[model samples]
Target chain A: MDIKLDQILFQVLNFGVVFGAIVFLVYKPVIKVLDERAKKIHDADRAAEESLKEKDAIDELKKKEKVRAEKESAKMMEKAREQATELKKELTEKARAEIKLDKEKAMKSWELEKKGEHAAMRKEFVDAVYAVTEKVVGKAVDKKAHAGLIDKGLKELAQAM
Target chain B: MSAIQISISAEPIFHLGQFVVTNSMFTSVLVTALLIVFAVCANRAVTSTSKNSRFRILVEFIIESLQNLTTGVVGTGKRAHLFGPLIVSFFIFILVNNWAGLIPGVGSIGIWEHHGEENIFVPYFRAGTADLNMTIALALISVVLTQVFGYSFQKLKYFSKFINFSNPLNFFVGVLELVLEVAKIVSFAFRLFGNIFAGEVLLTVMTALVPLIIPMPFYGMELFVGFIQALVFSMLSLVFFNMATIGHGEEH
Candidate 1:
């Protein structure tokens, strides 16, 4: 095989130039574009993950708020029930007191009416007795006998007084 | 009828001052030009924001494959980035040159010259890898660059791989390693040159004997061989670069 220095040198130079041209013209740019694309994909993934985490956080907060609101509503309902019970009890007690007062007032009026009736009956009886005595004396005795009985009655009355 | 003669040497096509440009050199220049043109077009097509064009996609595929290969061989991260471009360039240049040889007129169409008693056919174009000069040149570049990468990576420790003055066994091992380094140049050059030159001669002989459908299978085989040789050369170069960059004790 023939080996020439000049030829070898030329071929080396040719390869070197070709290598440099390819590296500069094609390889570097292609690699750069690839790296940039990979970076973009990574960034997109990271952002999506961050958004997911935020969404989860917000959902948790919403859940907690819902629970708190339910509890507050339950407490308010209980308070309302308690207040209704108290008002019912107070109204019943007031009605019972009014009925008792009415009964007492009716009893006092009945007693007063009964007492007046009794007194009227007693007065009527005394009048009747006096009339009967007068009739008996007028029928059976004379005027003088009547006058002496009246004088005796007057002396007994003075001594007794 | 005269017998077909294949010369081992590249035939000189023309002269430029003292520099004699051969058929192989001419083919080399043409291949380089073609590659440069392709590179320019591919560069223009590739953009960071858009990835739509077929050309851009093709280039990206090639570059990505090369990146993976380099990363596989040289490990990942910065070292892969540093050597990836060169390995890719070598593969492309050699592959294109190898395939370019298969074109109809490249090895067939040439001028016939008169020797003392016979006609000597000299092709105007030869495959770049078929020439010993070209292969040797490429091997030299690969070996030298390996050394450069070695020094750049390991500094003074790179020399320790070639020489160890501490012990007898270590020194002997260093010497063996040094011999192997030189042998690598021979191995690289001959492997490429032998494969491509054999393919060229095989095609030439087949065409002479049958000149018909007989050479079709051989042509296909040559195409496969060419591609394989290119891959082999670049892979070996990548291996060498990887070896050079790491410490001798480091795992491959």
Candidate 2:
């Protein structure tokens, strides 16, 4: 066996040099890149998870907003319906009052006309009676006293009718 | 017919001052250079974000696969990161060295030296792991790092595993374990060196015996052995590291 101390030492030193070269030149840098890529992937996954949670929260908010708007709209419709009913009631009352006032005024004007027509008929009857008397019983009659008596009888007949 | 010259040890190709540069050492240096070049290129490719190449993709696939294997054995987080590159480097180093023997010119192409009446064949390149020095170095590195990991993880508790005096039986077991740690180092060195060296010898002999179409199967077998040995070495190191951190009958 050719075992020599110096050669062994030299070989060991040679291998040691090789180990150092490989570690520095190859291993460390490659491992660094792998770690970086892994970290980046992990960060991307975490970001995606966060975005998903945010989207869920926004969806929940949207649902609540829609419900709130629906409730508000329903309340507005109810209020509008109440106002319409009130307006219809108020308008009906005013129209009824106007119709009643018009009916009363028409009744008053018809009654006044009937009174004027009765007065004119009475005067005409009085004038016609005086002419007839003059024709039938001619000469020596008292005009004032007979007229007064006929007028009183006609007034009594008009009041009874 | 020329006899097949198989040597259990690496042949010295040249000498610089007192330092002897063996063929195995020469190949190791070459492998190291190639690995460094590949690393520099890979570093450039990996660090850049503009374009992708198939070479880069294949390298990444292999690296990620090795990392995953380390993760499975050692568990992830920080420990895997620390152990992965070392384990991969071991595999790559041993694998390249093992396969280097299979190259056509590595064991065959050489110079003839006159030693008196006979000539000796001394190859310029030999498989690195086939040498005892290289394997022992690897084994020593593994064990030392294992101890370091144990201490770093368990602190004071790690030493108690080797030097426990709570009971006689426990003490004996501790001593046995300590010896076993040394045994582990020998085991690591021999297992790698034996397999790679034996394969080289077997190939040389098979070629010498036939010198024709028969050595092809042995070459294929060597390829498989080369890969298996590399895997075994790296995997064992990783397990030892894990065991050291967890330390004796303790749950991880």
Candidate 3:
């Protein structure tokens, strides 16, 4: 094969021009866009992943909060129940004490009334005896021995009647 | 001349236009067509959720590897996006050209001829990178692109890299930079030419020497060497590009 310098040079120049033109016009620009796109895609993917992770964290936190809230609510309910039970017990005990006190007061008042009535009756009986004795004694005697003898006779007569 | 030797030596293939189309050319055309078809089909068949089919996987692997190499060396900022496609195309083209050499029809199934007692085999397809002219052209494009990007990116600074006249020392540095640029072209051309030519020669010699089992291992090695050489050439170009774009302060 015969080697030609001109032919070789022409071929080289031609190849260079073809490749250079394509690179300048199409390849380089396209690659640049693609690269930018890749960077954007990578950034977006990272953001999406971070958001997903954040969402998971939020979900977990919500779950924990819910559980905590439930526990707190339960504790409050139990406390309220305990207070109510305690209050109910106190009120019931107070009412029972008041009923027992009223019962004692009523019994004491009834006894006082009975005693007063009995005393009054006794006083009346005494008055009647005095009047009767006084009348018997007035007709006779002003002496102490005479009065004593008359009082004794009247007491015996009253008792026999 | 023996009849058996004449039969082996005198097979002539057809021609197309000015270019003599032989079996090697046929194989190369086939390979090129296959690549185009693959690109088209893969583009059409792409889906979001589906795993890439076998062919698509292979193509994506090739493209992604190229992209990764570019990004790794040049960093993901500045001109990586700009130079990625150029670098990828360079790699793919050279890789295809280099791999084409290993096909059965390459350097074989050629137009055979007679020259007295010796046989002359004219190959239909010369491995594109193996040709000095082709490699030189590719090198020029790579180096020129480096300059273009540097100019566009740094503008006045890029020009000042070789045209500084502020002081004697600066002038001398400028001259040195100019000299380095020229040297870059030479180095690029020679590096690719030498590696590819050597690989071709090695394959040829190996085939001629053993013709049988020995060539198989060398073929495998040649494939590996071709891949490495292509990688090295492209990587070196990328490094040069990175260096150029980064300006004179940073080491490559």
Give the candidate order by descending TM-score.
1, 2, 3
Judge candidate 3 at residue A56 and give its lDDT: 100
Clash list (residue pairs), candidate 1: none
The count of residue-pair clashes in candidate 1 stands at 0
In candidate 3 chain A, what residue range of length 10 has the lowest lDDT sum?
Answer: A1-10
For residues A62-141, could you state the per-residue lDDT of candidate 3 as single tens digits?
A: 99999999999999999999999999999999999999899889889988988898677645655565566569867534
Model 2: residues with Cα > 4 Å off, grouped in runs:
A40-161, B247-249
Tens-digit per-residue lDDT, A22-107, candidate 1: 89999999988889889999999999999999999999999999999999999999999999999999999998999998988889
lDDT (10s digit) by residue, model 2, range A1-161: 87899999999988887787777877776667666867999999999999999999999999999999999999999999999999999999999999999999998998998888888997888777777777788853465778778878798977898
Candidate 3 per-residue lDDT, tens place, B1-252, comes to 222211211122565566543333344345455555554555544332466577555555666678788999877876777767777767766777778778776665556567899776666655656665556667777888889888887787888878878999998998998888888877876777677667667777777666789888888887887788788878988887877777666653
TM per candidate comes to: 0.75, 0.72, 0.63
Predictions ranked by DockQ, top down? 1, 2, 3
Off by over 4 Å in 1: A58-161, B48-51
* Clashing pairs for predicted structure model 2, backbone only: none
